[model samples]
Target: MLSFNIYLYCGGNISMKMAFRPTDGWRWYFDREYDSLMLEVSSDMLFRSCYPSKMLIPDVFSEFSFSVSDAASYYQFHNCCHSLNLTESQKIQLSINGIVAANFLKPQMPKSWYFSQQSTEYTPKVADIVKVYMQEDGLEVCMMVVEVGEHASLCIIAQPTFFSMNKTFYFSEAIKVMNDRLALAQQFAQPDNSIVLDDEELELKAIS
Candidate 1:
């Protein structure tokens, strides 16, 4: 399992610390100035940072609640996951409510001129929208990802609802609300930067 630390800052001061383990997904941590958040997945692990707010961590993981004061912190955790190169299984587990859909289109490869080989190799590119949902403490969290080519954008919408009101609120109403929230989140979302891992570090971590 991979393990790493996530640090979030507010007004230039550390606001929160998050611990992420491949086996446990992400957890809240309070330690100060620990080791870097990097772990080996296959041959190496990569780290990079972008507009943190673009990836909403709180919505993806149920362990943390969304709050205005610590909003950036949540993004920081999401950035850490990107840096750590989380696996598909890890991501699905983090979506505690279970993934609604994860559809992807296969990217076609160009044919090589050297040989008469049919380009049978294709990479699965995640679709523009990837959604996950979870219900907790009288609220429902919806996490969605909008991908453009190789770039991915994230959004999280939390809505308040009660089991008692289920009869009163139409399912379509809930979907509309979720859709509205998603549109709003998209306005502030940005594309993520690519982070390449170091094979040497990955080997060391794997052995350690």
Candidate 2:
């Protein structure tokens, strides 16, 4: 069986640990620096799906590697699978066959999104606009916020292909936007109505 050393950050320090190996399924690894946990499914397992299967992996995961951001995201993802009572191999099959559903496991916003849910004041409203800075490419993307629930919000990027594209932003940068909005809200002591993306702001480019 293939194995991988998973590294997690605790108290600002990194520690390595071996992921659990079941009789079948993928290997999971937590690479904290990337703020995402990686899942590697074997080619043989993927081949089990016949042609025209919905189990299509994105080009980004050409190496059969998939990832979910943060522990909460992973927890939400696993819960969504209804695999808590299923065997390891069953869980793998569920994930493979339910690629579209698995996408919802990812956090819509940053961890602060959850924290803000506990406080009504910080909860994002529908049509709330926020700026996102993509550190990897130094591009800024504008997100129109929609409240998912008391604990989360959906950030829809403003782009022509936004609905069909897979776009991601750094959690840290999202937190910064939340902080800026909160500061503004506190200073104004009113329902801040800043939902417009600056015309001067640069538009985000598609990844090649």
Candidate 3:
């Protein structure tokens, strides 16, 4: 489930409106009175400021909401997944309602590709977005530790070979490698589908 907060500006005053969404989508509304913007982003999203700053903090990347103060002060935002360990043949499927920023969760290889303690059980909130994975065959599948909130992390493995392309048999090879890594993980994903956004009240509408 993704949520949005609209910013309306008139003269020198700014007002924000909270909009609930039922699904993963994006929308923006602007008029003479003010300009409104809505984005369905995930917890991994990051917010960047166009204003020049020397701070080395990178930027405040968290799951929250804020408003723009000045028209001259713009922002640059993007979606990213941190701690994602990938190979040359592997690719991350990304989609966002707003923006995202991610970094390595570990200091070294293999173990460094785990999610934080606050991202695993993360339920689909108003700002929650969706993400999918794609990988070639023969690639070893590893388990990812997702930290949902303030508590423990959920360890999960990639699903089995449901999709394949060409005669390369990439999907089969990938599954074989994954089975070698952890046979139990393969079993875990067999019954579970990809992460889903569960919001009944928010409806996805076409944006013009």
Give the alpha carbon lDDT tens digit for every residue of 1-208 in model 2: 1111121222332111224223334444332333333444332212121112122234323333344332333333334433133333333333332332223233334434222212224555543444433433323344444333554454433221111112432211222234322211111111122222232211211111
lDDT (C-alpha, whole model) for all candidates: 0.23, 0.30, 0.22
Residue 183, candidate 2: C-alpha displacement in angstroms: 10
Task: Write down the worst ten-residue block by lDDT for model 3.
Answer: 171-180
Index of the highest-TM-score prediction: 2
lDDT, candidate 3, equals 0.22
Clashes of each: 0, 0, 24
| Order of models, best lDDT first | 2, 1, 3
User: Candidate 1's residue-wise lDDT over 1-208, tens digit each?
Assistant: 1221121222322111334333323232211123221211112222211112222232322223223323333333234234223343232222221111111112222111111221232222222122222222222222333222232222311111113222222110112112212221212121132122233321212112
The most accurate candidate by lDDT is 2
Off by over 4 Å in 1: 1-18, 23-94, 98-182, 186-208
Deviation in Å, model 1, residue 57 alpha carbon: 26
Query: What TM-score would candidate 2 get against the native?
Result: 0.22
lDDT of 3 at 146: 27
A best-first ranking of the candidates according to their TM-score comes to 2, 1, 3
Instruction: State which candidate, 1 or 2, has the greater lDDT.
Output: 2
Better-scoring candidate (lDDT), 2 or 3: 2
Segments in model 2 whose C-alpha atoms lie over 4 Å from true places: 1-123, 148-152, 162-208
